[model samples]
Target: MVDIAKVTTELLLEETKTSGHSPLKFICNDGYLYYCKYLVDFDPNEINCLAYEIVSHYLLKVLNIPTPDIALVKISEGTLDKSKIIKNRRLCVNHICFGSKGIDPSEELTEFETCSSKRDYNRILNQEDVVKIALFDLWINNVDRGRFINPGFNYNLLTVRSGNKRKILAFDHAFVFGGVEQIGVFNSKMPFINQDKFHDSDFYKSFISYMDEEEIIKIVENFIPLLKISHKEVIDAAIYQLPDIWKLTPNLANRIQEYLFCEERIEKVKTVILNSKSIY
Candidate 1:
């Protein structure tokens, strides 16, 4: 079983002013701040986002992309109902919710105006991670981060500054597998395996110059092996470990794992990345 750290939401801070679903900011009992996504009464389907958040965090960690540490946040009874803000937000009282540990000295990547420039790229401590994250988004069919064509970039990326350099921390996977609504329709047969949702994004363009074709190929090559090792043991652990409150049913979970580790889909990740704009 996955040993996910657990914390209790002791106090409600305020509604964070950010894109996607606005998670409630809270200072958990651990004395650290976390942006917690809770169940909402308005739409039960939204809970699917929490499942996506937790699973994606695990998968991203496996890919070695930097992300905020996640926790299984415990919201004591009446925590949401007692809040004066609950009326407007319409949050439910699910005891267990997904919490992403807050990062100090951090801001969204869009806040850094120079993020598109070479000068900013030089200060990024882990510049190569940018390439890794882009590929991960494609593999998961995450259209929320930097969709250039229609709704525009949602700016899900975060930048944590340290001295003159900075680190990129990828967050917000609620929209993966198409989106919250589409989560139900997601199956192993979906065409996500060879999709290209990331390359056209400005997020990818910001670091495209820094990427070497050979390096991108090598990264995906390394990732393919991980999918094959103890298939049920590694991938199933992510599904089974999730709290039952999220409503990630056995049938849905089975489809998700199948979609994620499908033999044909697993092999297509490398091909999709190679077809993106040639770095040469």
Candidate 2:
């Protein structure tokens, strides 16, 4: 279980151009820099974005995928400059917000637009995790990661370098479950499947060009057993962590739980990966 802690923002640094919820960077009382997403004032729909982010963060943890550490950051009054209109909306003050620990000496996958270098892949110590991240994206119906949809190719990935190696940390999941705007349309009967476009993107292909089909298959096949285990506790814990003040619909939370843990859906995803020749 994630020990979600509450911390206060100490100082505002800068607002990032990260797509959708353009989170601002701030130094928290924990003494760590975080990319914080604020609950926009007067926008109830913004709750969906924060809910998706927290749920996805826990789901990734259940899958053992690496991601930034999370916290519930309290944005005190006067924390934001009145002149700044951030996230295309007024920032909420004296409210709890979502925060992801900042990674320094790191670069986003977007930085390497279309890397075709084996050296780049070699630098990533956990390259096999690319396969896991691809599957996770499909399960969540994430549209923001690798595809150039309406938001336009927001990779939402960060890589940290340590000496000669690096590790990939997948972040920014506000657009998952068919996106924050489409929350009203989601239901238990709705299919949550999407083509694992993260696997098809040029950046993804470049990383695995050296990996043979069997090796990729091993990485994928290994995940099915883990998926077979019931994640009820994780799902419930994630939903329960969301503050009531956020006002996310209970129905949407239930649908997300059903969509992610359905037995039939898991089988379908497994079959799609094995039959679609996605390992190539």
Candidate 3:
């Protein structure tokens, strides 16, 4: 798990003025703005949103993936107008929360398509990054990487471009671990070793063609730190970081942390993703 920084939202900057599920935008006293994934939702009885975000952020960092800086912030009551947040993900009156560093609007970040269509998708994604993303998604069972086809998807594959230079800072993992639709099945969700649907996942299917076992191993080796950290330590950190409101139990944290750092499960995920590619 990452050493998640803590902050107090000094100002609520911009919010999801649209109809989709987007993070709340705000500025901290440090003058750095952040887009926080709130830790306040437990109503749908589906996802442990805060735990999911914290774990996903930590894993991505360990894997050397490019992502915005992450931190936990305490939002005092009345600091933010709860109405501004998207429906169902309302802000808490007084809560310790977690989220990622925000990207400034002036940065001109843009979104792109992510699909199997060769004509419009080929030039937009980097093969190496794409493969890494595939491996990561397969391991995490992330479901919302490219929900671009849906209307008002808000953010999809957000990217940055600057005069012949480009980069992608990844964020938004709300759908990890089967997400809301499959939340009922999280009790049995074993993504690391499960192959039934990973081969068909957009994050895996679109990029597996460019990958082989050797490349997959290299990516896994690059992320060795993920295994280096003890699972117990991860669970402990998660427990310590999350506020009491979310009610994420240690057992549930253990449930989520299981197999994430297991070597055997990692290899299984790699095998499934590699086997997805036809050798013809």
Candidate 4:
């Protein structure tokens, strides 16, 4: 139902420049603001960027994570053929920022740095925080990806308002699926389990800790219904655009279905979340 015909490269550039990120703005015809990051080289005929953004937003919402808003858009002066344009079909946009506050982490961690670290299985994530983040990732099917490298912040630590303590907002989800280099793996290359590192650094240990197992379960159970709803919406949208999308990446059609229906090891996750929550 995204109106791809309405989008133009010039309009995309204009909206992007205004948003303050890289020179890309995501404006939806339905009236929403989306921050974008171009992964592949920019091209006029390419519409997959809009598709990924739409699906990611939809999935995150389903998982009950505090993600940004999203919608489809049309550009006034696009580079694609005008006659092939479909009204209300084509490009979509994500339009949500948790708040106006910006993040300032004390340390910086790059994608490359994480990958080069020594393998340490004992240094696992705190169960509770992992659960929260995992829930977020699972809903969005951000498989094989990690929270540490999310571009929304300079680092992975969640930020909050100093006065009111409002939930921190993060955006720029255009890279949910594996890119040209790593087709299927989602998480960053850093090892997930590292007990030695966790014990050595209080800050690192605390970051992984959670509230309680019961509390973690509550959060997960609460998100199940939302996930179901989100899955349906995405499936419907993907089905409608299956023909066009298949032409771009045939694997996506099958992957989407597998991700939606896959059986997650929920009980094990609950144990981890509960144990981590007990750390503090």
Q: After superposition, how far is residue 124 of candidate 3 from its true place, in Å?
A: 7.8
What are the models' TM-scores? 0.85, 0.89, 0.72, 0.51
- Please write out the lDDT profile of model 4 over residues 192-240, one tens digit for every residue: 3322212223333344342345666676676544444326545556435
Reference-based lDDT, residue 106, model 1: 89
Deviation from truth (RMSD, Å), model 3: 4.7
lDDT of each: 0.71, 0.74, 0.59, 0.37
lDDT of 1 by residue, 161-269 (tens): 8889988889989888888657578877876533335555666666666666677677767766766453455456767777776676446667667777677766676
Which runs in model 4 stand beyond 4 Å of their true positions?
A: 1-23, 26-33, 37-39, 42-50, 78-131, 138-163, 177-210, 224-233, 238-247, 264-275, 278-280
Least accurate stretch of 10 residues (summed lDDT) in model 2? 271-280
| TM-score-sorted candidate list, best first | 2, 1, 3, 4
Clashes of 2: 0
Q: Higher-lDDT candidate among 2 and 4?
A: 2
Candidate 4 has a TM-score of: 0.51
Candidate 1 ranges beyond 4 A from true positions: 77-88, 92-94, 111-115, 149-152, 193-196, 228-231
Each candidate's number of clashing pairs is 0, 0, 0, 32
RMSD of each: 3.0, 2.5, 4.7, 10.5
Best by TM-score: 2
What digit string (tens of lDDT, one per residue) describes model 2 on residues 37-58? Answer: 8755365776788878888888
Task: Show where candidate 3 strays beyond 4 Å.
Answer: 17-20, 39-47, 82-89, 105-127, 147-156, 181-231, 261-264, 276-280
